[model samples]
Target: MSDSIRLDKWLWAARFFKTRTLATTAVELGRILQNGQRVKPAHGVKLDDMLQIEHAEQVWEVKVLRVLEVRGSATVAQTMYQETEESAEKRAKAAQDKKYYREPGASVAGRPTKRDRRQLDFTRN
Candidate 1:
């Protein structure tokens, strides 16, 4: 019902995020933007403003249609904003792309473990 709302609260109320804390964390990590620039959790959001929110590997471009300071139900929250067509398309494509790379038991696979590193060092010396 407000003309402007806190960014984190808006994100939760608009259903962009599941919780206020998650929204704040996203903002802190530079994953939330307004008008193409990163924004803080406390940033004030106004109607018709554009928001770029990064979740996982996908980015969502949403337009603020209304502002509510308090969180609401899923159906009610959905009425607070609208997602751009391009953003929806991009999200769909990103999901489809991920389907190709998904493999069972393929955990990140980062750098070698400590034991492996030590063995490599000994062999080199």
Candidate 2:
């Protein structure tokens, strides 16, 4: 591994974003921060650097454990960073909350089947 890497590249390698463009966009949009400071995508990432990333409606706090230039498999990418304990707890809580609340139509599962629609129509009358 090199001594450092660009923030966007590291994020891509770590699998935070599916593509480099997405990573760059996230960095530009203030969704990704380094040591609590906003940074350009070209910002250098070094060992033990802290990052706060917001994605998929959740915020993650992680420490860069290793730096790599190339994107790797999920398992390998995961090894590049370590999520903070608090972040993990917050993510878990958020996931639980989302599961309980859910989207307005998640349970509906798209348009109702004909039988279900007929039942609804009968009940409505």
Candidate 3:
């Protein structure tokens, strides 16, 4: 019920990460930042603080609204932080781009197996 909470716990409560451990790991790996500075998992998160978080290929810029000790439903968790308009737009654009233009190697299997290589050499000679 405190106005301030641990960074990891808040991230979990806010649904940024599915679990507190993952949030802690992200914080330790420098995937989470507070007001543009690297923060520890145990860092205190207060109201109005700006957070920059990276998950997968998306970056989020959010402002802390209220701290909660309990993790709640998606709708409730969304109230804990307000994402910036620019951040939302950027994420949407990235999603659209990724959907349209994916990595060329995503569906490709690189290199042939040893057996296939042997077959190719036999067929060649």
CA lDDT of each candidate?
A: 0.85, 0.91, 0.91
Residue lDDT tens for model 1, 11-90: 98888788899999999999998988987889999999999989877888888888988777889888887889999998
Superposed by TM-score, candidate 3 places the C-alpha of residue 10 at a distance from the truth, in angstroms, of 0.3
In model 2, the clashing pairs are none
Instruction: List TM-score per model, in order.
Output: 0.78, 0.82, 0.85
Candidate 2 residue lDDT tens string, 78-124: 99999999999999998999988755434456698887677666666
Candidate 3: give the clashing pairs.
none
lDDT, candidate 2, equals 0.91
Q: Which stretches of candidate 2 lie over 4 Å from their true place?
A: 103-125
**Residue 101 in model 2: lDDT:** 72
lDDT of 2 at 53: 99
Enumerate residue pairs that collide in model 1. Answer: none
lDDT of 3 by residue, 26-104 (tens): 9999999999999899999999999999998899999999999999999999999999999999999999999898653
